[model samples]
Target chain A: MPKVTIDNITIDVEEGTTILNAARKIGGRIVPPAMCYYSKLKGSGGKCRTCLVKVAQSSAKDPRPMPKLVASCSTPVQDGMVVQNLTSPEVAEARKGIVEFLLLNHPLDCPVCDQAGECDLQDLSFGYGMEETATEDDRREFPVIDIGDKIKLHMNRCILCYRCVYVADQLTDKRLHGILYRGDVSEISTFIGNAVTNDFSGNMIDVCPVGALTDKTARFKSRVWFLKPMDAHRACGKCPGKVAIWMFGNEIYRVTGRKDQFGEVEEFICNECRFEKKEPGDWVIEGPRHIKRQSVISANHYEEMKKQSIIDPIAGEMNKQE
Target chain B: MKSLTNRSKVVSNKQMTFWERIYFPAILNGMRITFGHLFRRKATVQYPEATREFSDIYRGKHVLKRDDEGRERCTSCGLCAVACPAEAITMVSAERKPGEEHLYREEKYAAVYEINMLRCIFCGDCEEACPKEAIFLTKELVKSEYQREKFIYGKDELVESPDPAKRVDVSKRQTKEVLEFKKDKRYKHNK
Candidate 1:
């Protein structure tokens, strides 16, 4: 066990736990943001320097803070290590620079893009990016590419986090592509004349931090916020059938692997469930799901329960109507 | 009420001569005036076959505009309903789902946009209030209905067609300034 103090919050974590995870252990407001790190995957950090934090003090053996800010996602916590995230002005400035670099070539097309509401790039930028871009130079752009029948890749919107490439390599048997170049010219592209034909191709779209990789079936179909995601499950052997059935009124829009409160997909659903099964009868409904915090029915239900609690405590908790 | 004829130049100011005051001369003058109107152009329009042209600023009926792609331009922001001086516009917004992109321009669209024709004074306030250029006053006349329920124009009546060819062309009715406002390239999803 190693003790790490993050932003005046002291927490003891298991040995070799990254500073990012240590922040999570003592979660409040100082949780470091990591774009490239997937908690489940091994060696999935150090690429994106978004989780940069200043070491105010290092281990007793070292007896000195690290001279430069380190990537919190990669650096393992050391005993007596004192890390500063939100409290450190230097850390905040460095995080902003990293986010700005990530958004350097990102196309500002939130209105038409399906990922406008649920996009990580947009979220991070709002939190860390500048109100106005510093560079007056024209932004880089690549044509909208059709990687497969089900996936449309817009290179202009990519932040080059490489999460999709990493996912493809780890999860799929056939890894069609990798980062093709180096530096700012780098891009995710398949081999010449090769198409992304993986069974789990849709997951890349879900994994994309930006709207660069989009599901063709759901492309420009609807904004993410407009969807009413309901929990549904069906019996299947290929993959788990538990999924979030998205709906606009009575029409079943599409289905995706169920996401938790943190917006991470619970499982990698098969392409059959992702692309094909769109009908309401495809799965058994588990009542109305409260995906977003503010759901109309849930809000009303809560209000009703609160009102009932004043009248009768048992009825409020049990939801027993007389 | 005072008669306008008192200010009219055609009215006799003095007593007429004996011959001029005679009933036969007055009757003859009346007959001449009645005959003069026969040669003039017809002021009436054949009710169904022909219609009179309204003035340039005439606010006849409201129409929701569609973009060149035929997708609805309204994001259901409720600016029109808020701007309606007559409090005629009523709408409920819903997010555009997958497969409905061609139907709406943005994520949130008016699931139910109803303009109470009975309440609307055709003030063009909703047209002025619309930020998306989705709603506008059009020269197209509102169809008359016997029932009050028909007066409340729903999305079926308010929304434009998905096909550009089928969309109602209200650009002609818009002034040069409004046309410029309509062509504003803001709020785009892509470059």
Candidate 2:
């Protein structure tokens, strides 16, 4: 175990522990922006550069690169390593640049997007992005692509994050998705232009940080901001694990990987648990029945109902006497 | 009601005054209001020929990234999928073959990837989720489709060439280590 001081707070961690884990252990106030860190998966997948941090006195031999900002998700903790999360202009610039770079291709459809309220990009843009963009005319043009029956591919909104493919392959033990091309032109796709038909396919919609991927059934139906989420613990219909169901307006719209049941560091919700099965009354809001005034109090209707209600009963004699 | 002040019950048919019938003052007032608007600057923008400047942080279309060697940066890791709140992304991974090394930089490559353009909300979580910087949401916003199927982009459409300014030249030692690691026995299953 080695002791590392992150922002003046010293903490002891294992040899292979990354700076993020150390920061977590020390209860540091610094925000670790992790985009690809699935607690349930093996790989840290330091794909997003949002979690860069400055470290003082990095290594004994390499002293020139001291206080060099590194991806906190990938940098392992070293003895006497002083990590500074805030107060670094370079980290701020990097984050701003990353946010700017990300927004270069993102579509401005939040007004009609289903994930407007719960989107991570919305939050990050509000926090890190600049007030305006530089190149406005050089926008990418693409038509909307539909993969299959359940999923609708909105390439305009996709940021090319590979979390869906990762979950399908690494965590769910299913190999259903992959990226097809190289930089700035790459996208997530499937074989033979087939739609994603996996049972756990709906989970991808929930895990997507942006609105690039969404459930076809839930699309254009309700904005995420309008949804009132209720917490309910129930066993997965397909898997044995107890999953968290998010109910909106007394109807279950979707289910997600539970962070509470699975530790914060071990956030693994299987594909079976993520996809929501359409039940008979899942979306039906049961309110008081609307009885038409014309159909109210029909004697023939009551008489026929009374005759069918008495099979072998004293009620039959009472009805006959009446 | 009858008028009481008539001297001989005279029914007078009055003619209009010159100013009242001509209505020149009212017409002049109307012309003044109309002429005022002519001098004002027009607020309408000539679209297609002229465009509004987008904010520096405006979210728009997506961009697939490439590495320095023009290789696909996506390792099919699927972190973007996890980060996506909409679950619009789907992919299939394939082991890179010997000849296809130039196409992809990693042993594991994405074979099939699709994003439903109709279902996407454009939040950029996929950009944040990508570990390899393979996916990005560019400022481009001209996404229109005549057919829904054409909107769904494949790998050939998504991957982009890496920017020369942003590319970092890997050291010879690092490149050797990567090649060695690729040949290592642990990666045998992947290859």
For each candidate in turn, the TM-score is 0.65, 0.51
Question: What is the Å distance of residue B49 in model 2 from its true position?
Answer: 48
Off by over 4 Å in 2: A59-68, A259-322, B1-191
lDDT of 1 by residue, B60-169 (tens): 77778787777888876655665667878877667677898888787567777899999999888887766576788877788989999999999888776676577766
Clashes (candidate 1): 0
Candidate 1: segments with Cα more than 4 A from true spot:
A290-322, B1-191
Error of 2 at B120 (Å): 33
- Model 1 per-residue lDDT tens digits across residues A1-322: 7888999988889999999999977764688877887775566778889889999999857869899999999899999999999999998898889888887677665644667656777778888899656775667767667887888887888777788888788878989977898998898888874788888777887777678888778754554555577889988777887888877677777777776544567787878888888888778988556533342213222222357667888766454221
Task: Tell me each candidate's RMSD, in Å, in order.
Answer: 13.2, 21.9
Residues B64-182, candidate 2, lDDT per residue (tens digit)? Answer: 66765777776665556555667677666565667988888764577877776666788878866564557776656736879988777777666554566754332221235545654
Q: Give every prediction's interface RMSD.
A: 7.3, 15.7
